[model samples]
Target chain A: MLEDIVLGLGMIFTPENLFWAFFGVACGIVVGAIPGLSDTMAIVLFLPFTYYLSPIAGIALLMGLSKGGNFGGSIPAVLFNIPGTPQAMVTTFDGYPLAQKGLAGKALNTALLSSVIADACSDLILIFLAAPVAALALRIGPPEYTAIIFFSVVIIAVMAGNDPCMGILSVGLGLLLSTVGTDPHSGSPRFIFGFYELADGISLMPMVIGLLAFSEALRQAYGWLKRQAEGREEPPVHIPGNQGLRWQEFKQIAPTIARSTGIGACIGIIPGIGTTVGSYLSYLAAKKCSKNPERFGQGALEGIAASEAGNNAVNGPNLIPLVTLGIPGNLAAALVLGAFMMKGLIPGPTFMQNHAQLLYALFTLLFFSNLFTFILGKFLVRYAGTLGSIPETLLISMVFVFCVIGAYAANSSLFDVFLMFAFGLLGLALTALKFNLPTMLVAFFLGALLEGKVRQSLAISNGDFMIFFTRPVALVFISLALAMMVYTFAKGFSRRRHTMSH
Target chain B: MIRGKRLLGLGVLVFCLLLWFLIIPNQTEGKTGAEFPRLIVLFLAIPGAVLLLRSGAATGAAPLKGEELYALRRTALLLALVCVYMLVIPKLGFYTSSILGMAAFLYCLGVRTPLQIILTPLISVGLMYLGLGLGLSFRMPAGLLP
Candidate 1:
């Protein structure tokens, strides 16, 4: 192992590997900052380009892009209340509020610092603990998967909106929307509404771009116009003195970054449960552990640290299941697995013995990519701060156009554009109604997986519902979810009582 | 606000019923296909009921008026403009539709400066061409425009 590590380090320090890592990180930040584009899309786009390069250099490039994209997403989420990726939604809760308070620089830097820290920790874990962790991940069956997702949904619903009921309703609506298109078990169309495009159900790109980006543009436009009516000029986003994350601030959020990294790494090893859930669960856990939980959705630096660290930490560990079990943990990991297959390096039990040096080299490259993400992310923070100076009207108009392009480009379908517009309007309404839009979107993202797991668990049990309770891991998660819900209700009751007494 | 919340709850209940009785039967086949959706409908109805029961105690804020109303109208106009843009894109193509849409968006936002209006769309479209066209090589919709 020591010899392999040494050889791997030597292999990765080459000029070609270093250059591709740098280039990939640079492009990733740019691609990830855009609303409709994702790391997955970027990986797919650049996968062919990797064919011309050496295997290590090519894989290094993809790894760098994946890591850089993780942090790049927070730039938009912090600055504009628009998440560049679905998982970054958690960041927008406090990040955008911090930006509005003229602490965009501090928020961005906190996100970057935590991202790098958590990513490095997870990479170290991936390097040393892949086999054992992959074995643990294998023990998670459909019942356990369903329980975990259900627990996440319940926690998010209870914590998301001002009214817990509204959050649950939002989640329910999202789940219902997800139930559109074909029924997976029956192989029959459920709610196509006669549009053949609807056969695949809702595409995520349009839904996310519409809900976050386009709706945000509309909201900003309305606010700017309203301020114009009142003859008030909107203030610039970043205040000069409030721009940096002090060492003391970093010290404060270090524990949060650590805790969230743990959560993210644990979740990442399990296939299908994604970064969005990791970040949200971490955010909720952070809130639960904080001295003042109410400060979370406001301008809290700890919140940013928890979210960014949580999401970015998932990247390294997400590839573990792929490398050790030949099962991709998520879409990004699946794409990376594709890159592996392209290089004729099949990942499975025997893969380690066959290509130990090469695998270790790739793992070594992940650490270097983290360094690249930090340097490149610093430049992105500075650039995004300057963008805050652009006039609100012009910036929002451009964002709206970008949203349109992004939605359209996803499938080059006019129907998708229409879907984006519809969802944009729905977003506007939901915001006005005080529903938690992120909870809704996350629920939409996970609903299919949860449903499939639940149904599969039931099938395995011969339609017996006792399967969930009989399974120890599943029972533990279910109990935790119930405890959380009860606690939330009790807290709400006490708060209401205190208000009345006062 | 309370009224709206109540209405939202009622809407949820109504949809739950519609989905359970009408949409699920019409759209889905086989026994298992509708089972999961039925469970979800039940899940949705509980929150709807809870919202209805609890919202009566919630305080309401003053309704939109004056500048808020005007701002809403402006947003509506902007949405309508986007709708029009989407309709025209397949007919007039991405570049032409986007240029027209951008100009209209600026005008709607009360930016009457002719140079700003003309230049913003041109620059935006030009950048889009460079990025999506040349860089990513996406085949943007070229409708009737040569």
Candidate 2:
């Protein structure tokens, strides 16, 4: 193990690996800082580019993107009222308020510091603890994986919104959508209608881009036009100065960062509870433990630290499932998994045995990527004002073109452009009907994994329902999921009763 | 909004029922293979549809406010512009189509300046062409203009 660590360090220090690491970090930061663009999209867009790079370099690039993008999202959350990623949404609770109070620089500084610190802590945890976790994960059979995914679905549905029914509906819809492609085992067309392109299933990138980016663009356009029509002018944003972090402030928030990072690392290691949940859970935890919880949503530095740290910590452990189990923990990791396969490298039990040096090199690159983010963040903070000041009209127009081009470039299919538009309209209508798109999208993302695992489990059991119950690990996950559902409903019922009583 | 929700509920309910009848039977063979879990989705969709309808009926129809109407109309216009852009891009080539599309979008978004009308589109098309075409080495269609 010591030799492996030493070899990893040596491999990471090579000029080629270091340069790729730096490049990945830089690109990740830029993508993450931009509103409506996600780390997943950034990785998906660049997956084609990885075809020419070495396996270590390619994985290193993706690791840098994942780590840097997590922290970069905080920039927009702190400076603008907008969150660049869903994980950044928790940061906006206090970050936007701090910016409004002209403490943008301080808020950003705290966010950056906490992000880097939590990231480093999580990576160290991963380096030392991954083997044990992987060994445990290796014992997980198909039934266990199915149970974990089921638990994830339940958590996401319950936490999605005030309406659990709608959330479940969204998940069902997502599952249906996932079935559109050709069946993997039987080679039978499932839901392709008549189009050959649909045989491949709806491309994940286009669906995600349509649901998230295009829908948001439409929403922003409506808001922009309404403001213009009302003759409302946004006040010129005030740039805040660096009132360098005071020791007193650090003393107040350091514990929050530490706690949040721990929570994030745990959640990230789990397959289904993603960065968004991690950020929100950390924010809630910080608020609960704060001396003055009342100051929580109003520019509290602790809030920023908790959210940023929580989100950034997800970068390290999110890779655990992928590198150890050959299963991607999320969409971005799925794309990275795809790149690994493209490079003729499969990730699983024997992966470490065969590619120990590359794995070490990837870990080393991840550490360097965090360092790079800290360095680049200093310069980006100074220029953060430029990002927010871009004219909304121009930005929207540009994004519109990119959407068209991106859709076209995906498969060079005109039919895909139409499919993209159709999904965009579906997304718009769903939003109008008050459905939660994030929950729906996440469910769609997890649908195949859930289905595949369940089917495999059933195959192994020869139609025995008790397979899920017989396994202790699977039983625990099932019980947890049931508990979560019961708790969510109880909370909802009590809240409604309280409202009615009042 | 209530009417909209009701309409959506009906649409989804009908779609679900149709799928339940049409799709599930076809999938029955794969059932012994991977079928039972899908029943969860099917059962959930029925109740989901019911919940949607019940919620819609519980809330009386309310006319959209002026602000809401305006926002919806603006969104419709944006969608229309995108549709036109997609329709024209194949014929007019990437550069011209993108410039025209961008200009229309900016105009719809209330950027009325003469300079903006000319410069924004040009800059947008040029930058995208250079970035994707030259820098990324991804090709855009030339279309009618070659």
Candidate 3:
């Protein structure tokens, strides 16, 4: 193993690999900085370009791309109060407020610093602990998978929103939406409403862009018009020049970064639970532990650290299940799965055993990609900070166009654009109701996976309701989930009683 | 405002009930398709019932104040415009429809400045053209446009 590691390190320091890693990171930053384009889209677009590179270099390029993209998303979220992707949504909670305070550069730098720290640490964890975790995960059957997922989601629902009922409502609604289109096992369409495009269920890209970006455009427009109604020209934004993170600021958020990185790495190994959930759960944990939790959603630097670190950290360990168990953790990992298969590297237990040297080389390349991200991120942060100076009206208008273009480009379908617009309306309505939109989106993301697991478990048991209890792992998780729900309800009930008396 | 929120809550309750009825007869190919959806809807009805029952206590939620109502109406109008924008895109093509949509959107957003009214759409269209034409190499949908 040591020899393999040594050999891999020696193979990775080549100029061609290093150059591709740098180039991939640079391109990824640009793609992620854009409102509609995402890391997944960037990889799909650039996959063909990696045909000639060695597997180590190719994977390295892809790794750098994802890392750069992870941090790049913060650029827009901070500047515009609009998340570039769902994974960056938590960043907007503190990021946009920080940008409003004329600290956009500082926010970007904090995001970058936390991203590097978490990503590098998580990569180390992936290198050392992947084998054991993968072995453990291999034992997780359909029953266990369903129980674990149920437990996690119930906790997520309970902890995510201002009120527990609203959180559950949002998650329920999301799961319902996920039931649209065809049932995966049945090949039967549920609620297509006669549209052929609904066959594949609702595409994630249109819904995400519509819910976050397009609705944001409309919201900004409304706010701008309201400002005009008040007969006040909006105050010009003050974009600071030297917006880099100071050591003092870094020191303050270091603990939050460390905590969120640990949280993110742990979540990363779980199949189908992606960066968005990791970031959100970490943000929740950070807020819960913080002395001044009220400052979190407003503009706390620690909020930025927790969110960026949590999301970015998942980049490394998310591949663990994919490479070791042939289980793609999320959509992004699935694409990486394709890239691996395309490179003639079939990932499973045998592949890991055989490609130990190459795997170590890929790991080495990823470790260095963090350095490239940090160096290049410094310069890009400056460029992103300048976006604050652009007129809100013009920027909003451009974003509107991009939202349309992005929706169309996703499948080259006008049907997607219409779907995007409909989701935009739904988003606006949810916002008006003050609903927990992120919970809905996340639940929607996880709903299909959860449903499939539960149904499969049932099928295997011949519809026996007690089968879950038969599996020790499943029994443990299901009990934990029920206890969590009961505990949360009890806690909320007591809190409400206390508040009413006060 | 309180009445509006009360109506919203009541509407949700009714919608869930209606959806429950709709799901009853709907047969799916997979064994779990109908069953899983039933479970989700049943879970959903709990919160739906909670909202309905609790609507009486929450009188302050999203009160329909004049400004707030106007904002909602404007948002509705924006949604309507987007629907129209979708319809016209296939008719007038992406470039023409996008420019038209942007101009109208800016107008609705109260951009009275002539320069902004003209420049926002033009600059946006130019960028879109470069992006679609060169970046993705996507062929423009030429409907009525040359």
Candidate 4:
């Protein structure tokens, strides 16, 4: 291990590897800041270039892009309430609210700090715990996946809004929306309603951009018009908040960041769970554990910290399963696995033993990449304050055009653009009606996965529901879901009764 | 009487009924395909029914009033303009439609300054073209801009 580390340090510091790593991170941040584009897309676009480069340099480039892209989404989410990626949707909850209050710099900085710290810690875990974690991850199956999804949906719904029932209804709406495409099981249409565009199911980019970005534009435009009518037509200039994070503030949010990092790291080791769940689950945990939970959706710094940390932490360990067991954790990891295969490198149980020096080089590069992310993120945050100062009229209009482009870019389909507009309207209506839009969005994100897992489990069980209970991990998650549901509803009922008596 | 949560509840109920009776059978085949959706429908309906019954107790915030309603009309107008912009994209081309759409938005938002109006589209669309079309080589629709 010592020799491997020394050799790894030597290989990673080469000019070629260093330059490509920096370039990849730079490109990734730009690509990921766009609404429709994602890290996976960036990886795919750059994967061909890696074929010509040395193995270490190529892997460094991809890993750097993954790390940079993980944090890049928070920039837009902080400044505009528009999530560049779906996982960054959690960031928008508090980050945008902070931006509105002229704390854009603080929000961005908090995100950067937490992201780099969590990423470094998770990378260490990936280096040290890869083998054991991969072995444990293999034990997870359809039943466990289903149970986890159920727990996640219920927890998110219960904690999302004032009314747990309303939140559940929103989840239902999202789940229903998710079932719009052709059924994977029977090769029959479920609810396409004759729009062949939806045969592949509703694309995430269009739906997210419409709901988060476009609807925000409409809402802001309406606020501007209302101000005009009220004769208070002065558009307030958003001054940049104090960019320097105080030591006291850091100390306060440290535990939240640490907890979130753990959650993200654990989730990342498991294949197929993805970063979105890691971030959301961490956000929920932070909110639950907070002394002032009410501050979460209203621009808490810890909220940004938890979300950014959680998502970024997933970047490193997500590769653990891939390197240790040749199993990709999620799409980005799968793309990286593709890159490995393209290089004629097959990672499995004996991969580390065979490629000790190469593995160590990657690990060393991962640590340096975190430093690069920090320096680069600090540079990006410098300009974020200026973005906050842009006038609402211009900003709103520009955001609208960006949304159009983003929706169109996702599938290169004009149909998606129209779908985005429709979802925008739906978002507005839901928000006006007091539904938890975030809960709805999360459910929509997880809906297909949940359905697929449940069906698989049921198939294995031959139509028996006991399969979920028979597995210990699945049983634990199911029990938690049931307990949470009961607790939340009972609390809600008591609150309603108190309100009625008053 | 059927406003706010109650209205939402009724909509949910109607939708669930439609799914159960008409949509599911028409859209899906076999028990395996339909069962998950059926479960989701129940998941939605139960809460929806409870919402319908307890809507008075849950009575969300008050409805939009006077100025808020007037503002909503303007917002709706802007949305209509966006719809028009969408229709024109394939016809007038992506860049042209984007510039026009942005200009319309600025006009609707009361930006009368020519520099801001012109520069907004030029900069936004130029950056978009440079990044997406040039940098990434995305094929933007070429309606008329040869």
Q: Highest TM-score: which candidate?
A: 2
Across A96-166, the per-residue lDDT of candidate 4 in tens digits comes to 88889878888888998999999999999887776465456456788986887787677667766677888
Docking class of 1: medium
Local accuracy of candidate 3 as per-residue lDDT tens digits, A256-350? 99999989998887654679888999999999999999999899999999999999888788888667755556656655654675577877545
- Residue pairs in clash, model 1: none
RMSD of each: 7.0, 3.8, 6.4, 7.6
Q: Native-vs-model 3 lDDT?
A: 0.75
> Per-residue lDDT for A254-306 in model 1, tens only?
99999999999998876556798889999999999999899999988889999
> TM-score of the B chain in model 2?
0.74
User: How does residue B11 of candidate 2 score in lDDT?
Assistant: 73
Kindly report which residue stretches of model 3 are placed more than 4 angstroms away from their true locations once superposed.
Answer: A1-111, A231-369, A381-385, B1-16, B27-33, B52-74
Please report, as a residue range, the 10-residue window in candidate 1 chain A with the lowest summed lDDT.
Answer: A233-242
- Record all residue pairs in model 4 with backbone atoms less than 3 Å apart, i.e. clashing: none
Clashing pairs in 2: none
TM-score of model 1 relative to the true fold?
0.73
Please estimate how well model 2 matches the true structure, expressed as its whole-model Cα lDDT. 0.76
Interface RMSD for candidates 1 onward, in order: 2.3, 3.1, 3.2, 2.4
In terms of lDDT, model 4 sits at: 0.79
Q: Per-prediction TM-score, please?
A: 0.73, 0.86, 0.74, 0.71
Instruction: Judging by TM-score, tell me the better candidate of 1 and 4.
Output: 1
Chain A TM-score by candidate, in order: 0.64, 0.84, 0.68, 0.61
lDDT, candidate 1, at A223: 85
Q: Give the lDDT of residue A248 in candidate 4.
A: 99
Every model's TM-score on chain B: 0.89, 0.74, 0.71, 0.84
How are the candidates ranked when ordered by TM-score, highest leading?
Answer: 2, 3, 1, 4
Say which prediction, candidate 3 or candidate 4, comes out ahead on DockQ: 4
